[model samples]
Every structure is written in structure tokens, then in C-alpha cells.
Target: MRLFYPRGSDHEVTRLVRSDAAAVATLHREDFARPWTTTEFDELLRQNTVFGFAARVIGQPKAPLAGFVLARLAADEAEVLTIAVARAARRLGLGRALMEALLRRLHALRAETLFLEVDETNDPAVHLYRRLGFVEVARRPGYYGGGSEGKSDALVMRLDLGKAPVSR
Candidate 1:
């Protein structure tokens, strides 16, 4: 699936590869308080059940990744491991595109459901998941951090593939 943007965006989504670990790790660090290391990403990429997509700028052979989504599919279910878009690239639709790509792939594999956990304080992410037809199925209090103030709750969101609204 190819989604083209007008003049402002050269971003294109593609299947992620092991070599993308370093760039993905860098992007993860920009958002998450405890980001996964490059080695960890590489190891995840090596797993048979793990797959992902990366959004990168077109027109350049070596454009740095703008965003990425990692996921694991087991049997008939799938779960988002993590997703992040570079701070500079927010609001540009890369995150949605990556997720849509994943949904398409999961549909192809006959996946029954998709699950993801997001920090409740992340309004943008929570809104995006809701827009994509995911609903809050559960919550884990204090799942995000142990900061000075308090840890944030994590919303466990689920999307039933049969009802997923992303165009096939």
C-alpha cells in the first residue's frame, strides 16, 4: 500500500529490516523514558513472530527513518510492542500510516485481534488508537514510570480484526 503526501511529506512506509535497529532505537529514545537498545531491537527483529514497519523519506536512498512500529503476532493474535515517531515528525500521519500497514498485514494473516498498551497521559496516542477503532479493554495502574510525582496508568487497547475500520 502506497500513501503519498502532498509537497510537505516525502514519507513512505515499508517493511522493517534488522539493519534498521540502530535508527529505530534512536527514534525510540526520543520519546520513551526507558527506550529499548539497538541490540534489543535487533534481537526482536530476528524473532519469527516479530515484524514491523518503518516510515522513511522518499527520494533519498539513505533517508533516516521518520517513524516506526514494532509488533508481535502469535497464532491468531497480534500486539504492538512499541511505536514512535520522531518529535519533529509528529502530526504528519506517519504513525497512522505505520499502524494501517500493520493492520493490513495482520488481516492478510487472518489475525483475530490486536492489542496495545499506551500511557494514559499520552493524549495523542490514545486518540490515534481510538480513531483507528481500538477501544480500551483494561488498565494497569502505575505501569508507565516511577517519577517524583507518580506513575501513569496504561490503557490496554484492543481492536477486533473483524471490525477494524482500516480499509482493506
Candidate 2:
């Protein structure tokens, strides 16, 4: 199990595994409207194309995760499926660390590009992606429902792996 600390963070980034399904599912429910189930997470974790990272407090390996990121890689492309941090853990750099870990793994795998769709109204997530060098590529109107303003547009963002991330 490869585990490392992201610079300036107290959390450890570790390889996500099948047993993490239940914990990640619980975390997912905190942020998503229609959260994925543990069974769904299990299936995804079993897939060869899917991989992810989980963040946990240093020295507390058995404790609940602070955050996680799930992604799928096919050929030279990768797409983030979902990412979530516990409400209590927000602003502690867990989300950014999970995403950065994914990026580093994708780079090592020689992935050419990465893509993700985020709710346009999610300012924090949008800003995080922008800081990571992701740019808007397209949009899907009413892609998500039941937001404060009813439905919301989804912003499709892309990052070319050849370029360095924008310095924060």
C-alpha cells in the first residue's frame, strides 16, 4: 500500500481499495444529491479501468477517510467520476491532495488528457479545477436537478496532461 503525505497537508494519500466502498459511499452522500451506493462503489472498484485515492489523517490509518477521488482511464484519456470530502474536513486541502494524486498517477501512466463535469454553481470545485489548469470545454444544461435554483448546468472541463498545472 503506497501512502504519502501531500506537501503542507496533514493527511495521507493512499490507494483506494475495494474495502473502501462503504466508507467512500458514506462520504459521497455528504456532497451529492443522488449519492452512489456501496454496491455501486464496489462494482466500480472492481473494474480494471477505474482507480482512485483516499485521504486519511496521518497516524490514523483505520479511521474514516477525510476524502476520496474516483476516476477511470481508457487509452490516453481519463475522467473523474466523483470526488468528495467530509463536511468536517473541508478547506483542509484533502480535496486538492486527492486530485493531485490522481494527476500524478495519470501522468505516470502517460495519459494525454483528463476531463470532468462539475455543477456550474459549485464555486469551490470550479475554482479548484481552474487552479489545477482545467479549462471549460462545454456545458450541459439542466444536467443536475434539485439544486437550490432547481436544475443546474454542468460545466465540462478538460486538462491537457502535457502542460504543467497552474501555480496556486
Candidate 3:
């Protein structure tokens, strides 16, 4: 799947390509406590059940790779592996754009629900997911590690796509 913005628009989302490995790795490293290597990302791209995407500003150099979202489909469920926006790109709707794109793809794949685990202390991401209709369903203690604050709890959130309200 693909999403495009008119020329000179703020951001654009596109299907993940092998050529995106370097930029993606850079974004992930800067955004996550533990980032995936290019080879690891390549392996993920090779998986039949995985889908990935990248977001970029219209005229940015080096793509900046503002953000990316990854998910794996199983039966009727899709689990978001990770979604991260660069520090410089937060609050610009790149994360939301990537998520909307991912949701559209999951809908196309006939997914009934989406699940993810976010750091309990990540107020910004938690707010975004909640705004997107994801509800906290469970918690995993000490799910995140090696941050400035040490280990943090993980909140498992779910979005029931099967029953999601449709916009008029």
C-alpha cells in the first residue's frame, strides 16, 4: 500500500523498500532505546507476515526518515512491532500518518484487532494510541530497559478494528 501528499505537502508515507534500510536504521536508532540493525530490518522485510513503512517530509535531504511503523499479521490479529518518529519530527503528525497508513493496510489484510506494547512512561505515545482508540488491556512489568530512568513498565493496548466506529 502507498500514501502520497500533494507536492510541497508536509509529509508523505510510502511502502518500505530495501533502499530504506539505512534511513530507517538511523531513525530507529535515534528514536528507540534499542534499535535494529540494517540486517535485522532486512530480515523483517523478508518475512511474509510483516509490513513496514516510512514517512518523510516533502523536500527533506537524506529523507530524514521522520518515522516508521512495523506490524506482523497472524490469523485475524495484527501486532505492531514498533512505531517511532525522530526526535526532531515529533508533534508534526508523522507518527499519526504512519499509524493511519498501517491501519489501512491492516484493514486490507482483514485484521480484526491491533495490539501493541508501549512503555508505560511514554506519555506522548500513550496519548497518541489512546487518541487512536487503543485501550489498555494489560501490563507487563519491566518491559522496557536501559533508558535514563532504568526499566519501565509496558502497557499493552488494543484497538478493535472489527468494531471501530466509522467516520461519516
Candidate 4:
């Protein structure tokens, strides 16, 4: 999970498009040790069950995104692929906004549950998820690459949107 960069309500979240893939890739490059390529993002977007939203400062619709959330759906389940926020935007509530938007979208798609895996060390992310009503469902040992020659555990979290409130 990452912070969405724009300050205040200056940002707006909208459905991501194929043209936004490069910009999203740039974000991954800046935020992740191992970044995904534009082609990878394109492929993910091309999938029928995959969709995402991009956050950008209003009035600068053409500007690179401040953050984005990608997810994939299968039947009643949806998994958050990743979330990235620009370095400039951390500790703000943009991440929460994106996730609220994500949950709403998933609910519209009839997703019964949402799942995501976050690095155990991301306290902010874990806290956010918990506060959003996600619970620890499982743990994946060494799922993320980092620390001690690229090895870190991941906490699997789940939110039962069917029983939770989602903003429209």
C-alpha cells in the first residue's frame, strides 16, 4: 500500500485507462525496489476481471497520477494487486480515499470479499487495513522481497465487504 500524493480534495479518483499504464509504471519505479514494466501493467489492465482507479490533482487531468489501486476479481472474491502513492504524498488520507473508492467499486461488481497482502513491516498499511475492517486471515512467510537478502513475511488480510459499509 502507498500514499496518494495530492494534498486535500485537490485530487480526484477515476477509472484507470490503458494510456495511464506508463505513468503507473513510473510510480512503481519510484516506490518499489522491483518495479513492473508498462507492458506488465498493460497486460494486467487487459484482463477482463482486472480494473483500477487513478488519482490525480483536479484541473490537471493530464498530469501523472498521484496514486493508483489495482485489483482483480473472480466470482465473489477480489484481490488488491497493489497500491502506490507518490513519495510526496504520505500520511495523508489519500490512501484511505483510494481504498474507499476501491471497496465501492468492488461492491458494485458484487464482490463479496476483498483480499490483500501487505508487508509485515508496513505498520501504516496494516493499521489502515485493520481500521477499514480487514482482519488477518493468514500469513505468508517470505512472500515479499526485502531485508536479509530479500525476504520478508506478508500478512494476508480480508475484508468482508458484504458486511461492511462502502462509500459510493
Candidate 5:
């Protein structure tokens, strides 16, 4: 997947590797309240069913990653663990591209379903998933955050990879 920005950018997506842990962690920290540690990323990459990829811009120093997606597969079912794009890279097609790439992988693996959880307050994320053919199948009240920040509901969305709409 080319560095999947919505527009005004051209980059490519590369298979996520153990070496990408730091960059992934950095991005996760900036965007997520509970970010995965570098060690965690390393461990996930070691799992046979876990898969991820990093999007990077061309000619950039050290090729800083612009976005990423991670997921796992098991017994015809898969779950999207996370997908994120840098703040500077938002509104680009990176998120969609990541989903498309993951969908391709799931399809190749014979996965029948893909599930993900999104904060109900994340309009962009919810919209993106809906656009990608995911449907709300369940919901968890106060599933995210803790303490003073208050809890947020998580919408459990499902996409039947076998029936996913073709990317345009």
C-alpha cells in the first residue's frame, strides 16, 4: 500500500517488522491513551498469527513511519488490534489503505470475519469502519479509559471479509 494519505502524499506500506517496534510505539503513544510498549510490539510480532505493517514516506530521514495497522487471525476469525496514522497524516487515505491491506491479508488467509472495537466518540474511526462495510454487532459500556478521564463505550464492529465490498 502506498503511503496511504488521502491526498497530497505518496508513500508505501511495508510489512511490520521487529525493527519497527520503536517507531510504532512512538506513534501509538502520541495517539493512544494506553500505548503498547516496544517490548509488547516485539512480542506481538513474534506470534505466528499476528500481522502488522508500517506506512512510510519516501526520501524521509530515517523514514519515519506515518501510519500503521495491526491485527491477528485465528480459526477463520480475525480482530483488528489497532490502526493509526500520525496527526500530521490524518485525513489521508492511510486508514483506509491500512484496512484494505489487512482485508487483503485476511482474505488470503481464508478468514471469514474481522472484528474491531472503536470508541463511540471517535466519529472518524466509526465512519471509516462503516465505509469499509463493518457493522455494529455489539457494544461495551465504559470499555475504555479509566479514572478521571471517564469511561467511553466501545462499539464492537464486524466485517465479513468474505463479503466485504471491493475497494474502489
Candidate 6:
């Protein structure tokens, strides 16, 4: 699908293009403690069922890849595998924009529910998901490993896309 953002803006969100894999990988590595490699991204793109996105700033040749959202679709449900924004881009609303675009894409695919797991200690992400209408649905012990002190629990969140909430 073709995505367009107004020109001359400081930032813009665009669909993940074929050439974005490398940049995405770079951004992923910079943003996450553990990042997926370019080969992994290539496989993901070939799957034809995963949706990814990238946010860029205008006039930048390398488009630092402020953030990205990766999701998988099965039948009528979708799960967000990961979403991350570069450390410097965290407070710029890139994560929220990436997720909103991803959710809209999932809705078009007829997904009735969205599932994701967030680190229990990630308050900002938890708050963002809550504001996005995703509620705590379950918890998995030791879902994350190698935390500051040790392994940590992960909180599973879900959003029912079947219901049209007044807020976006």
C-alpha cells in the first residue's frame, strides 16, 4: 500500500517499504536490548502476513527509523510481536503513531482482537496500551529474561477491536 505524509514536516509515519529492512534493523538494534537481524526481517517480509512500519523525519537521507511496530496475523486475530522507539524518540509520540497505524491495518484484515505482552516494569508502555484500550488480560511469570536484577514477569494485554470505543 502506498503511504503518504505531508512534506516539509519534522516527522512522518510511512509503511515499511522493501528498502526499509536495513534501516529498521539498525533502529531495532539501537532501540531494543535484543534486536532482530536483517535476515530475520527478510523472512518476516516474505511471510506476507506480518505488518511493519517505520517513522522518519523529513529531509533526512537515512531516516533514523524512530520506531517500528511488528505484528502477526492468524485467522481473525492479531498479535503485536514488538514495538519500539529509539531512546531519543520515546517521548515524541512515535510509538503511539506506529501502533495506531498498525491497529488500523489489522482492522482492515478483519482482526477482532489484538494481543501483546509488555514488560511488567515498563510503566510508559503499560500506560500507552491502557490509553489505547488494551486491558490487562493475563500475566506470565518470567516471560522476560536478563532484567536489571534478573528475569521479570510480563503482563499480557488485549484490545477487543470488535467494540468501537469512543476514544481511538
Candidate 6's displacement at residue 129, Å, is 0.8
Writing each residue's lDDT as its tens digit, candidate 1 over 1-168 gives 344442357788888999999999999998888889999999999999999999888866377788999999999999999999888888888888889989989999999999999999999999999999999999999998787868999999999999998777
User: What stretches of model 3 exceed 4 Å from their correct place?
Assistant: 6-9, 59-62, 146-148, 165-168
Select the stronger candidate by lDDT from 3 and 4. Answer: 4
Q: State the C-alpha lDDT per candidate.
A: 0.90, 0.90, 0.81, 0.84, 0.85, 0.78
User: Could you arrange the candidates by TM-score from highest to lowest?
Assistant: 1, 2, 5, 4, 3, 6
Candidates in order, TM-scores: namely: 0.93, 0.93, 0.88, 0.89, 0.91, 0.86
TM-score of 6: 0.86
Error of 6 at 161 (Å): 0.8
- Local accuracy of candidate 5 as per-residue lDDT tens digits, 50-160: 998777886573767889899999899999998899989888788887788788778878899999999998999999999999999999999987788789999999998
Error of 6 at 30 (Å): 2.2
- Candidate 3 vs 6: which has more lDDT: 3
Q: For residues 1-168, write the lDDT of model 2, one tens digit per residue.
A: 655676677789999999999999999998887889999999999999999999988888789889999999999999999998888888878788889889988988889999999999899899889998999999999998864669989999999988847222
Candidate 1: count of backbone clashes, pairs at least 3 residues apart or interchain: 0
Winner on TM-score between 1 and 4 is 1
Q: Per-residue lDDT for 121-159 in model 4, tens only?
A: 888889889989999999999888766668878999999
Residue 3 lDDT, candidate 4, scale 0-100: 27
Candidate 4 clashes: the total is 0
In candidate 2, clashing pairs total 0
Rate residue 48 of model 4 by lDDT.
90
Write the residue-wise lDDT of candidate 3 on 28-130 in tens digits: 8876767899888888888899888788776664657878888899899999998888888788777777787888788877889999999899899999898
Model 6 scores what on Cα lDDT?
0.78
Order of the predicted models by lDDT, top scorer first:
2, 1, 5, 4, 3, 6
Better of 3 and 6 by TM-score: 3
